[model samples]
Target: MANRCLICDKKKQVGVSSRHHRGVAGKQWMKRAQKTKRTFSPNLQWATVDGIRIRVCAKCLKLIKKEQPKGNLPEIASK
Candidate 1:
């Protein structure tokens, strides 16, 4: 499977770790995403099985919502 999402081409994303401090100095590794995960990707990649062109972020699969409805119309127009 492709690491990047078919929509937005957000790349080079860094994951941060969150930990609670117990007065003493402490650090925790929050399993940051691999560098390879944040790589090159197409800006407008089409969706699978539906062909919905979208802009998404890799690994996160984020989509840019478009408030417009555009698609093919039926041969027979409904009244």
Candidate 2:
């Protein structure tokens, strides 16, 4: 299983967490803050599209359901 969304092409992103503290040693300066690495992963789910099962994000799934035409209508062909 990959950490990517099939429909929206979503992927993991890198982030940082910084720590803040008060001044020390009676000086009006703060110590160097620490940074922690973090990853933001997308919410993905398994869904079937055009008879194919693949991973898609929640937003895309919602859009697909909303945009699908009602009743059994053939898709329009564009040149």
Candidate 3:
């Protein structure tokens, strides 16, 4: 399955991380900082829309709930 949200088209995002050392003179120095690979994925859930099952993010699901009076996830409107 695709690691994405169909309702909002959300996908995984890559990021980095690093660290620094504190200097003796009350200062911080980047002596040897390294970048690390990381992924940020949205909170997704299985939802049925228009008789089709699709991966929808939690945020979108919340919005759908607000927009829908029946509290049922109908056909997800596309952009």
Best by TM-score: 3
Q: What TM-score does structure 1 among the candidates reach?
A: 0.29
Q: Which candidate ranks first by lDDT, i.e. highest? A: 3
lDDT by residue (1-79, candidate 2, tens digit) is: 7788766678899999788876677764557677899998888878766676777778877766777665442232221
Q: lDDT for each of the candidates?
A: 0.36, 0.70, 0.73
Q: List candidate 3 segments past 4 Å from native.
A: 24-30, 70-79
Query: What is candidate 3's CA lDDT for residue 71?
Result: 53
Regions of model 2 farther than 4 Å from truth: 19-33, 70-79
Candidate 3 lDDT, tens digit per residue, 2-79? 888877688999988666654555443435466788898889998766567678899887777676677565455453
| Clash pairs (backbone) in predicted model 3 | none
Ranking by lDDT: 3, 2, 1
Given candidate 1, what's the lDDT at residue 60?
27
Which 10 residues in a row give candidate 3 its minimum summed lDDT?
21-30
Clashing pairs in 1: 7-54, 7-55, 7-56, 8-55, 8-56
Quick one: ranking by TM-score, best first?
A: 3, 2, 1
